[model samples]
Target: MKCALVLCSLSFLYSQICHSANIVAFMPSPFYSHQIAFKPLWLALAKRGHKITLIQPNVIVENNENITHIVLNGTYDILDKYNHVHSLVEGQSVMKVLYAALEAVMEGLEYQLTHPGVQELLKGEKKVDLFFTEFLLTFGFSLGRSLNAPMIGVVSMDTTIEGHMSAGNPTHPVMYPDRDMPYPLPLTLKERMLNTLHWLVDRVMNEIFLNLQDRVASKCLGQQIPLNDIIKNVSLVFINANPLFNVVRPLGPKTVNIGGGVHLMEPQPLPTELQDYLDNARNGVIYFSLGSTISSKHLSNTTKEVILKTFSQLPHDILWKFDEEIVSKPKNMKIMRWTPQQDLLRHKNIKLFITQGGLQSVEEAIFNYVPMIVLPFFGDQHNNAEKMVARGFGLTLDHNKLDVRTFRSAILEVINNPKYRERTKESADLVMDQPMSGLEKAVWWTEYVLRHGQTDHFRNTLSDIPWYQFLLLDVILCFLVITVIVAYVSFKLLQLLKCLAYKLYGKLTRKIKTKIN
Candidate 1:
């Protein structure tokens, strides 16, 4: 009996050991927001007894035994590149801005790949069970292939048209606009036409840029693998998008929506000074931030003057995230270089969020039931703002047309309006009512992919079909050809029958005439 019990215990221990995996997550994007969105997934994996080696730009995960942080040097300067690009491309077309951004990303990827740590890993000394990385960067896929591990792509923002296309997710531009366009749904004919054009332009541009990345990546790997094949073969994609803020669209079987995953955790305690300020606010407080990427100090002088002047008129106290101190700031306002945004939003005294509509900021606001006054600058910020307005819980303002009068009035209107607050609270409740937290769902799916190996079963059939066949264009042409042939044959047969009848009638008439004579 003792021997049998010992054997069973050993077997159980071995099974548990088998379940644990060595996951290497390569997120070399220089954008801090992307790192913020990806942190929860890596942390959750670390908590679940899996060993993680995260190659990130700005974040460091300290004091975790299961996780090793590999910070890439010389990558932090990407923030400067972002600021320069934003300044240069203020009024440029979305495609142009996207191209500029992608060029920077490619540069960042090249820098990361050249890092000593990354070079060692690529040399195949480490035994990796799973490889995870951002989906937007095509070069990262090569690392997974190099390690001979299953790859899982993570989208740090809402699903993009490129991602949907790559994953074989159904896309209807008429109903679902491109990620760059901010037009509301139930699109007009003109809007639909523009939306279609935007989709095509984006798709073509992505292919060109991605092919370039693939070439660079191929050279680095010392092997030639087609980028398209790598993308299609990814075991799964975990997206930080939910139906609440995202347009309802078909998702592929391997595409997992883990929206609001990072915000699912309880917020940490606010700093003492911020807590005191919020506690003392009798008329409530408005928190304003442009997110981590965009610096408030970079705003033009006129813009800054208008914003400050507008905030002075508001009855509510304001907390602005500014990198530099304002010498003549309003007495009712406070400026902080940084504050715990999630913690500040959780405070009961907080009334509204004035933001740039980054996905992380929007998700945090929605989770905390705070309405927003959005002034979007670029990328998906515009689209996010539009969705918030469509949901009836927020309003959008044009930063270019922003003046003191307009800014002040918008703030007052949102503050005085009870419906916005009510609707936002309702949305928060609905969003939080999911069966499991986003983290839990993410971890479950990650392990599922690990246990089951490649997700061939999860791939959509549409992925394999050509566009002509998927759209039934060929089928439609065949049906039209058959109809035309049948119609022509029937018309000819009818004409022949008519001639025969006429001839028969003529014959009958002659026979009758002869009989009468």
Candidate 2:
């Protein structure tokens, strides 16, 4: 009996060691928000005894000594460091800058796909059991397939693939729209038409544009490697969003919701100067950051003058994360190249935030219940800001019309108003109510896919149908033609019966007249 027990214990220990899987986390360069958002997740998995390899350029991984940083060799460091493609392209229109950035990322990613460094990483002897990568990379699907491992797409947006827009089950008012699932109840005619338009636009951008980008990127890899096919073959997708703030629906086994994990980032101590300022500001302080991608130095001199002048007028203290040193400083405004954002937001003295409306900043604001005046700088920033505005949690400001008067008014409105604070509190509550941290849920589902097998059902079924056929307009046209034919036949039969009755009645009338004469 003793000998049998020892053997079983040894077997169990071996199994545990085998289960300690290695996860390869691919971090695409050129976007600070993506890197920052992923930091917590990488750390969490490392702490849990999973080996993680972070792929990026100019990335620093400390504290979690267990995690390995695998910097990919690529020449797109210009896009990553300068970030001019995004922050300086539009001058004022943030979306234009955003679209340009996406285009640049697509272009740079294509270059990286063909780079010998990236190819070597993929073909390396180190066996990565699982893959965790951002959806923006687009080529991650290909990498995942090349490694013969399960791929989990980490989406910053609320749940839904670009192609799955109309599938969301829309509840009353449709607060948070998911890309897949049927709308809860039947929509009215007008609502249906509007939703159809929304679906069309979203599909074109997400499915068509992105899929095309993937193809182009694959071609850059020197031959034909079907990237879309690889994506279609993936096992799971992890969306970083909350159902409370977002619309929830039934998803297949492969997809999981894990959003709030950003808050789990290991908090670092604030610099003494910042801490002292917060202590001095008895009333409250305003936190302003345009995000890392958009440099403050890139803004036009006119706009900078307006912003600086406006800051001079504000009574509350301001902690501005400006990359370049300001020649002139306001009495109340202090500029730092980097601010401990997560730590500052959690501080009680921080009252309001001024941001570029990136998902990371939005998440931080919601996490801390800080009211915002969102100056959306591109991609999904407008959509996120619009949603925040709709929820009454904050205000959206157009960058084209940015001026001291407009910006000052928007700030004062958010700071003075009670509704924005109230809404922000509600958002905070919803974010914190999650049963598991976003990182935990993401890691769990990733492990689940490895334990089980290919979850083919999670893929979008529409991919099977041709683009034109998937629309189904041809079927609708056929049905209309059949209905018209049936109506015409019924009309012709009625006319023929009426003619026969009239002729018979006329003959009877004539015979009666002759008899009377």
Candidate 3:
């Protein structure tokens, strides 16, 4: 009897200590930057004794007993796709380029969905307590329905205009321009009108895409489920943007801004050679990287020559993340295929960051108090660059119109300017002043959802209301109708009064004539 009681106690203790929840995340974007942005959240959860099944195009972290990685092959190469897209959409409107980029992402998602591991998950053999995916690919929400689990969205960049709308966040187009439009806040009348039109176009395009996604997901899931319904049921969203980098807007309770989420951790030590170079730089150093998606080798030869020649003229030593070897590299420039970007930014000697304005890169620059010279290529980079300029911490230049003189001058201006550094430090302080680190907030909210098992209390009811109703068009129409009816009645009453007075005057005139006779 004593042995049996001891065994029962051990069993109960084991159960209590191992109450693990199952979480599945699908991040199929081909960009390493996106993976980096999402890594911290997953790692934190995994460390907390949860079972994670991650479906990604690349394996960012190694799998252990609790973490399972489902690697998807044949994913779209972002650089090749970008090059092809630019060739096809050259001289086209920004909207055209935006649509092309989204299409490329959809293609990647489709490939991921058809993978064997994803198919096995969709089979629903294992119970999933939660599902997480990037927000831009709305079809990924279908996984929630497939597993009958709550869904969470992760935005690698600032929440898109449509994303804000989906989460029932307040979006003033004038105040919060879409990521594609780089106009500063408090826009002019023309800019506001254009921003409004951009929102409308984005809505229409999103509807069309959602329909396509629904159809594709239905085929993949072997059942018909509306994409809108899936989006409406999302329990939470983790947006990788902070208020420091974004306009002031109201977010729904379900929408958690984990801006600087990726920057919460201490950076890894730099390689010995790189550390030596930075340690020995007496005249300060400038770090230039166009990010992972856009390679320096893919740039035009003329552009490359201009950049190199301009860098050679600068007083500061240059560290360029170039993909290939240059035949005649400048003496002051060091080229590497990959660099510990975050680690390098932490160095005191690093003065300025010349970048393509990718969101992650911008956040790193701000977190490290390094001002920027932004040469945007496409998408949110333009908007980020504009914000940097608006915030007085950076300067923007057109990559296509870049000349040696302009490039060199822009660098000098940022380096020579005191205001940029001061503003950058101020912004960095604001970004880091959060009560809790972004990763901690994300994990806490995620666990909150897990513990509650339902987040209907947090969901915004505005998501269910039609756009027309949400905008109060119905109320406006009712007021207009009431005004028109009241105005018509008052006009008729005045006409009737005027006729009665005229008749009275006519009667008085008749009486006066009769009396005179």
Candidate 4:
């Protein structure tokens, strides 16, 4: 009996070990916001006994032996030198913004790929079971291929045309505008044309980036890898989007929506002083922050003055996350370099969230059931703010056009109306109504890829079809040519029949005349 029990125990331990995998999450993108979404997945995977080697600019999740970090300290520094977020506040063209972003990331990622630690990862003969990489950063695909392992692409925003192609999904530029575009749904004919043009431009720019990816990645690994091979290795894509948060569109089987996980699913404990402030507010509280990338203190002098003046007159207590200290502060206002945003939003007395419409921030607002007055500055913020208005949960404002009257009126409009909060709560219900939380689902799918070796079935045929064939231009041309040929033959046949009839009529007339004579 003792021998049989020992054998069963040993077998169970073996099965557990088999399930655990050595995962290399090559998320070298230097954005701090991206880290918020990725941290949960890393920790969850670690809890399951999966060993993770995270190659990022900094260590987000610490104190875990299961997860290791390959910290490249100055990656974001290289990106910041090129990032045009400040220029975007003044309203630049979409093409300019897109190109600037590509340049920033391309340069930043190049710096990361050249790092000694990252190079070691590329050359090391470590046992890698699966690879997780940012879908936008295509270079990681090379590393995945070098290790002969399947790759999962992670998108932290609305899936771009490039991201769609990577996951084998359809791209509907006409029906759905790019995330950066502020056009509301039911686009005009001219708008559709512009959207298509933008789509094509982005596609072309991505190709340029891809060529660089191929060259740089080849140099790093000392192997000649073609772009086609880098593209084919993507086994799955986890897009950080949900039906409620982003426009509902068709997604490939391998592409999964795992949004709302970036924000804290459960509210954290508020600090004593902050908690007292929120609890003591008799009227209400307004929480304001420009998110992580764009600081509130960096606003233009005129814009900042207008905001502060407007806040002084508002009836509710205000909390602003300003990076710098102010000389003259309003009695009802509190300025903190960093406020517990998630926790503050959870307070019952918090009436509104003044924000700069980031994906994670928007999700946080939706999940917390807080209506917002969104002041959009850059990339996807415009569209995200417009969507918030379309849903009746928020209103958008141009930060450049900030006046005391405009800012004051916009805040009052949202607060005075109960419809916004009502709609927001309804949205919260939708965001929360899931079979599994997005985090659980993400971890489940990640392990699913590890367990199942071959998943080529997930790719759609639409992905493999060429652009010309996808539009059915060849079929349409063939049918048009056949129709023209048939029409020409029918016309000639009619002419011949008409001539024969006329000849017969003339002959009959002559025969009748001859008989009469």
Candidate 5:
């Protein structure tokens, strides 16, 4: 009996420790920057024995046995070829610029959904405990139903309007700017008007987008997906903005702020050539990159000439993430096809980073206590850059107005200013002071969902309510009807009283007249 009990106990312990769930993550974003936020989370889950099937345009080059990757190879090509950044920098209407971006995203999404690999992955019924996807990729809603799993939206930056509405998070237009709103807080009257307009425009655009999405869904998934069903399936959200670094806002327990440098990992040793170059730079080095989506090659020759001329004049050495070789490169500048950005930031000799102000790049800069200059291109980069300037850790420039004089001046300002460096150190401390690492929080929450079969209890009832009801329009209409009825009754009573008074006054006057006669 003792021997049998011992064996049973051992078996129970093993079962408790090794219960791994099958997770499906559909990340259709074409940009490598978008993948940075959640990449560590999946890997952490894989390390914990969960099997993850990833569907994305960008794949993890690093191999893992528990993870399977399905590449939507043509998606990135579609977005890159669209080339909407120039219009954004040229000060196009916010709505028009965003609409163009939406068009690009839709085109990319069509390619992704129709990809033979993705279609193959979404085939038939499968046992999946949890589904991970970008919050804005509403197409993933259908994927969840197809796989029979609950979804958790992963946002690389701030969550979108759809995500906010789906999760019932507070998204007041002026207070909680949409993912597309680039204006800074304490908005001017002009900005408030524009934001209000954009809010209305966003709803209409979303309707158009949904119509497009529904058609795409029918074509590829062989069924139409209801937006209501999609909203209901979003069990949790992991937004990449750490509250400390972001505008202070209220988020329910279900929406996690996993941003505080989620992508940061242990710094790897830089290549010997790169390391030696950075180490020998007595004047410190500036790392410049336009991030993953915007290619440096796309810059106008005039802009490139200006940037190159500025770099040549700077005393500080330059490490540029240039995809193509420069024919007239400066002696002080070294160009790389790709950069180890995180590790480079970690280097002691690194003084400043010149970037397109991507959130991931900004977070890495903050975490490493580096001051930087931002020339925002598009999307959330503008907001991210504005926040950096507000925090006093960075300076921003208009890419459209970029000249050798202005570019060199801004670079020098950020680098020479002691306060920028000081602010970065303080900000880095606050970011690092979180109770747990972002990766740990992400992994724990992911596993928690897997362990709990039903997550509806965590959802807010506001998400399920119709928009009319959500705004209390029904209540308002009822109140208005009641007020009108009461007002009519009161008016009729006053008229009746007036008639009675007039009759009594006439009768009294006639009685007095007869007595006098």
Candidate 6:
């Protein structure tokens, strides 16, 4: 009897500790920057005792036991397969690649529905408990349906109109962190026109791809699919932006702004040579990196020489994150293939950051409060850079004008400007003061959906209302039309009465004159 009681107690304890539910986070693009943005969230969950799986093509993890990293090999090679895409030289924007990759993934999914690899993964032996992913990639929705689990979308950018509309939030360019409307509730005529134009562009893009997505999803899932409806049912959204970078606005529990979730790991000691160079230089250090995907080695020799020559003139110590090992690194310059970015950025002596303005780098600078000299290439980088410039935090450089003179001037401006440093510090302070770490907030809300197992809260929220209903413009237009009709009729009646009265007076005067004569 004693043995049986002990066994029973052990069994119950094991079950209680096993919140070790299965989760899969899907990112459509194979970009390293996007992956970095999500790394903290996955790592945090894995630490808390969850069985985690990250699915993408060519993904690498630092190798933790609690998490499983799965790479979908062939499906992701579309980045290289499209030769035209590779040949297209973009400066600093990533939008084109983002859009192209999304199209390719959707196409790949369609192809994979018939392929063995995708089929086997989707047909896993165990059911997934939660599906977490970037909302821009629609595959997570299908995965949620496949596993019958709740979905938590990780937004890679600020909540634009499309993002808000998809999440059932109000449609306006309000500051996300505080959820405050920067402008009036009812947009002015000019605002309405611009908003409509932006909305139309998004509508056109979404419409063009609907048929393609449907066909791809159906072929992959082995049945008919409702891509539109799946997007409509996301349970939670985690935006990768903090309130510090944005104006304060109201946000719901489901849509958490967990910006700066990228874990700022501590720095390891610098390599001896780089340390020696920095030690010798009396001036401060400057870090230059174009992010992960674009290899610095890919730059033409002329551009490389120009950059080198420009840095040679700067009295400051330089650490360049270059792809290839240089034949001769300068006495004051250190070229490294990789560095502990967050760790190095946190160093007090590091004065300036030359970045591609990718969201990950942007968030890091915001987290560390480091001043930036951005060279944006494409997509939201342009927008992100624009915001940084608008906020007085950084200087934007055109990639085409990367001549020595221009580069040197840009670097000098940021280094000299005390205001930029002050603003960056302010942003850092705001980012650090969040109520909960992004990981905790993300995990708690994800579990909340699992425990509840329904969408009652989201369903009742105003986000569920259709765009027409949310705007209430239809009702407003009807009221305006009725008011116009009533005013018009009243004016017509008054005009008619005045004309009749004048005619009567004239007739009476004529009769009196004739009688007197």
Residues 1-517 of candidate 6: C-alpha lDDT, one tens digit per residue: 9999999999877644536678877775567777667676677778878888777665556778877766666664666765324443443246666666666766666554445544676777888788877776565577667777788888765565555566766554322211222233356767556556566566567656655767666666744667667766778777866554444455654577766644444357876766665566578899999887666776667777888888888989899998788885566688888887876776677789988777778777767778998876655666667667867788998765679998898899898888898998886776677678776676677667655655647742555565565657789999999999999999999999999999999999999999999
The ten-residue window of minimal lDDT in model 3 covers: 82-91
Q: Top model by TM-score, which number?
A: 3
lDDT of 5 by residue, 1-517 (tens): 9999999999877644636888888888777888766777877888888898888877774679999888887775666576566566556787887777888887877787777777776764667888888877777777777666878888887777767777877766778767666676788999888877787677777778777877777777776667557756577888887654455568876788887788777779999999999999989999998988777888877889999999999998999999999998999999999888889899998999888988889888888899989988877788888878888988999887888888888888888889999999997897788678888888877776776765777777656666567556799999999999999999999999999999999999999999999
Pull out the clashing pairs in model 5: none
Name the regions of candidate 4 deviating beyond 4 angstroms. 1-18, 90-99, 173-202, 262-265, 494-517
Runs with alpha carbons beyond 4 Å of true place in candidate 3 = 1-18, 63-65, 77-99, 174-185, 261-264
- Please give the range of 10 consecutive residues that has the lowest summed lDDT in model 1: 82-91
Please list the C-alpha lDDT of all candidates, in the order they appear.
0.81, 0.69, 0.81, 0.80, 0.80, 0.69
Q: How far is candidate 4 from the true structure (C-alpha RMSD, Å)?
A: 3.5
Question: Which regions of candidate 1 are displaced past 4 Å?
Answer: 1-18, 76-84, 88-99, 175-187, 479-517
Q: How many clashing pairs does model 4 include?
A: 0
* 91: Cα error in model 2, Å: 4.6
Can you rank all candidates by lDDT, best first? 3, 1, 4, 5, 6, 2
Tens digit of lDDT per residue, candidate 2, span 51-102? 8777765375675767876565453564655355445525546666667666
Model 4 lDDT per residue over 1-517, tens place? 9999999999877654437799988887676677666787888899989999998887888899899888877876766675577557656787887777777766776677788877787678777899988887778778778778888888787677877766677777777666666576688998888988887788787778788778777776654877655675578888887566565677778888887645464667899999999999999999999988887766888898999999999999998899987888889898899876777788899999999988888877877889999998866788888888988987989888889998999999999899999999998897788788878778878877887764788866666676667657799999999999999999999999999999999999999999999
Higher-TM-score candidate of 1 and 5 = 5
